[model samples]
Target: MKIGIIGATGNAGSAIYKVAQQRGLDVTAIVRNAAKAREVLGADANVIEKNAFALTAGDLTKFDYVVNAFATPTAYQHIDLAAKLVRELRENKTTKIIFIIGASSLLKPDGTKLLDSLLQDENAANWIATPIEQAKELTFLKLIDNVEWLAVSPQANFVPGPAAEYQLGVDHLLFNAAGHSIVSTGTMAEALVDQIENPTVPVRTRFTVGDK
Candidate 1:
């Protein structure tokens, strides 16, 4: 399958791009700096250098799947990019879009959204905007009914590590046998590619993954 990854230089996106290549899939890195992409992905990597928001409909529709791993310090762009992509692909279901949203949108065991608890942290103000906007991104995505989209959230503590056994859950925060809510980038990438290859989750909904 043909796949394109935006923000392919980031931790999660790089992991996804590398995993896709290891599987021998036709993968392209949609990045801003072609040289950096080559440096990170490889000299042989196929790349399309352009700002993600500047990407045209014609550019995106060429791939069977596009993973939006674009992260920004400007948190509001999280929702903005989602809206732009949805607008570009409205009523066209051929190319599926997958969003790697923040874990703040997941649900706790008490049925409350995880963002609430995150907000209660004393130091949350230091880096709360991204999670807030990501929750908004998911909320906005849920309102759209026409686009073929899937959202995936990592566990409460997402770290840079290698792939491992993982368990998936729908809308709820999942914990492993040791009661830790965490997932490595590689594990998330593995789950995401599995979904792209064999889509089991219904479109327009969201799912989450945690280390097992």
Candidate 2:
């Protein structure tokens, strides 16, 4: 299958790109900087130099799936970009859109959202906006009914590391045997590709992954 990765140079996006290549899939990096994409993904990488927001339907329709891994310090841009992509793909269900969202929207065992606990932490102020906007993004996505979209949220602690055995769940926070909620970039990437290859979930729904 053909895939396009936005923010292809970023942590999650880069890992997904590499995993797609390892599977011998036709993948293209839709990034703003071609040189940096080449430097990071190697000289043989196929790249489409363009900003994610500026991408048009013609640009996105070339692939079977487009993965939005774009992240920004501004935080609110997460929802904005998701809205833009949904708007562009409205009523067009051929190319599926996959979003990488934050874990704050996942539910806890007590049926409370993880975001509720995160909001109570004073130390969360430094980077809490991201989770907040990501939660908002998921809410916005849920409201759209026409587009073929799927969202994946990592566990509480997402780190950059190699792939591992993972377990998947729908809209709840998952914990490992030790009770730690975490997942590596590689594991998330692997789950994403597996989902693309064998999609069992319905569109417009969200699922999560965690280290097993």
Provide the RMSD of all predictions against the true structure, rounded to 1 decimal: 0.7, 0.8
Kindly report which residue stretches of model 2 are placed more than 4 angstroms away from their true locations once superposed.
none
lDDT for each residue of candidate 1 in 67-158, tens digit (9 for 90 to 100): 99989659999999999999998998899999999899999999999999989999999999999999999999999999899999999999
lDDT accuracy of residue 110 in candidate 1? 96
Q: Model 2, 1-212: lDDT tens per residue?
A: 99999999999999999999999999999998999999999999999999888989888888999999988658999988998898888898799999999899999999999999999998999988999999999999999999999999999999999999999999899999899999999999999999988998788899999999
Model 2 local distance difference test score: 0.94
The alpha-carbon deviation from the true structure for residue 114 of candidate 2, after best TM-score superposition, in angstroms, is 0.8
TM-score of each: 0.98, 0.98
Q: How many residue pairs clash in all the candidates, one count each?
A: 0, 0
Q: Residue pairs in steric clash, candidate 1?
A: none
**Shift of residue 74 alpha carbon in model 2, Å:** 1.3
The true-versus-predicted C-alpha distance at residue 203 of model 2, in Å, is 1.1
